[model samples]
Target: MGGEKMLRIVMFPWLAFGHLIPYLHLSNKLAEKGHKITLLLPNKARLQLEPLNFHPSLITFHSITVPPLETLTLPPGTETTADISLNQHGELSISMDRTRPEVESILSTQKPDLVFYDMAHWIPDIASKLGIKSVSYNSVCAISMSHVRPSVLPKAAATSQVALSSSSYVGSVPQWSRNDHNSSVYFGDEITLLERSIISLSSADAIAIRTCREIEGVYCDRVAATFNKPVLVTSHALPDLELQLSPLETRWADWLARFGPRSVIFCCLGSQHVLDAAQLQELALGLEMTGLPFLMAVKPPVGYASLKELLPEGYNDRVSGRGVVHGGWVQQQQILAHPSLGCFVTHCGSSSMWEGLVSETQLVLLPQLPDQTLNAKLMADELKVGVKVERQQNGWVSKQGLCEAINRVMDEDSDISHVVRKNHAKYTSMLISPDFITGYIDNFIKDLQALIS
Candidate 1:
């Protein structure tokens, strides 16, 4: 960029939108600096991301069709975790591995200066053979990336697991992570997630995590040491507050406008992590118990036709004016940015975490998946920017727990509320400061150039 060469970078993220979206945002940032970016993703995702592409002149979308899987039976057009059940994401991981040939061919012909990837662990090996640099770009935080040092796990067929029981699981893994990693939710008949992650981290030339020193400096340093690679943090690449929020449905804007500023709770768990009917009822009752207005966006729980079907008996009738639990996706960024959004009950995905941090809303976490569990810990435990809903030993959240967490943050007089409020504001101010994100991106681009130089 400084009269030096611009790079042609390929972005091949895991099939899930959580992974795909961040990679695309990184691509946009790189492209803005005049680097040519070719993003390889499923056709459907390509279509969905087209509108969000800020640098169409320099960034191109190349769709990769998922090859057939022998061990898994998926309905037609399941390309991402959003398309399948939470536990079935291992199937998606297997499909990503199966695309190695297609990706290799693209790399061979394109011969890009560098490629950024995660989950597709084989990319670094193939890129090295082609004399190309590969950066294992983890869109999640460094904590999950550094959880294992890559040498510990071995790949096994997606058919039957290689058996990592609690007895066999090695050191420092919290009970939540251990339970999660051992569950079918983390792995499938293909290679396990631990293997996919560490293998990629070990082989890649550089490791970039979508985090910052403010939130996860120690974890980032640990990751660099663990992999012996230049581990760089992206400094919150999905800077939604800086970008324009599109008007999704006028009704949401209209409905939200009626509430006083910072008075309504905006609840939207991520695309995955669908609650059961029982849990959905608990969430509904919990928000209702807070006696605050809310807008909750979620799908019907398992076996229920709609969100309406899972409501507690006469639940809607009782909380009719105060709560609205609509089914399906909403423009979460816009919803979070709303003037009326007082509290955000989130799944603590990387995107949601960044968004909540940058916003003025109070953070109340209800994390479901394993990575999300760690993310919740970062905010609720380490950073003390939010309060987490206490869970039963079996990991099910109750209505009372959810209600208490929301009220704790929303309560003006409570000490815990005062702490999270003060801390959340303090960090948010640092994140939005001038040159905060730009400094990281400009320095990161130089680091990338250094790799190819």
Candidate 2:
């Protein structure tokens, strides 16, 4: 940053924690590069960012009170999708759309050099009115982005009215067909998300994707061609999760230490996507059948009062010493990085994928939604760093299926396991290498400078 002009950037990400965290990570990187970041978030969602330990001087938190949940006919304290049930996620997206005025007001006062927005479809127009440049900072991977972009799809599918499901579009890549949930509530209605994404991308001065050329160069290229806009790859801004262990983290760490190296399965389904009782039962039984040490963190599905109510009878007693099932929040990055973590059973979210890649742990993918399904495909089919667990035609995982997939990835002799471990090691070395990350950040800042100039 020597003799460089310091920039003032306004960042407004979607209301979800998953989206917010990545935006904060990017803000941190920009701040480190001598830029000032004004992060606009809902009051409650702003609380989620406080723990991330951002640079106090360069990054400022500006709270915008979201329209009350009660007024929106949504649940109280529902600032993010993580605070509500899956079915109610659509309301959260719609509710955020109502924050346009608040955002405009912030822009009017901040007079920032640029605005980096995610999923806020109306941002570009507002920024343009203020003569401020805007960039659509996508936190998702390039594969998912390209697959969803209409111009990248086949002519027939692209012209069709039906929204292409993630499995149908991405799984159909090459010669594959897999059933997946038709849509995701996380981004609201499928058609709406597509329209919004297209609008936002169309309006932005440039597109910033949280991916690297090594992983999805072709997709990134396709994105640039499709939109006819400059595409900037930020690589994956991996968050620093090496904070001192809390009491709960210490307990889990101590428990994992008892296992032999690379022998424990770490299962976390992220903040969203709770499991129903039947799915929970099958998953519990599956983990029990593995006969391997495991730690699972679950959020009980809708209508279930607690995790205990969702567990199968005597399930806890049966797997007493072999497994631990804790409900609610868990320090996921700490668990993934633990020496005993043999495999990661994940929902295949982009952030989780980056963490898993950095951890060098084999991935056991259990994708619960559309974007996750696409992520699973890229990890298993393209990257070859993970194994997607087999699900029934109706898209449900059984006890045996889960056990077999977990065992397959854990087994050293199996070809899938071997390839996954090999690829994981290769990618991990590249990701953690100092040169790779530094070069990526340098290029990203160069792109931002060009945009402003």
Candidate of highest TM-score: 1
Q: lDDT per model, in order?
A: 0.80, 0.79
Report how far off residue 433 is in candidate 1 (Å).
2.6
**On residues 194-304, what C-alpha lDDT tens digit does candidate 2 reach at each position?**
555656676688989999999989999988887778999987887555532233367887898899999999888887777778898789889888999998888877787
TM-score of each: 0.92, 0.90
| Candidate 2 colliding pairs | none
- For model 1, residues 224-327, the per-residue Cα lDDT tens digits are 88767898777887645446345657988898888899999988888877888888888888888889999888878767778877788898898787789999
- lDDT score of model 1? 0.80
- Model 2 RMSD in Å is 5.1
Question: Model 2 off-target regions past 4 Å?
Answer: 69-72, 150-191, 241-248
In model 2, how large is the Cα lDDT of residue 384?
Answer: 90
Candidate maximizing lDDT: 1
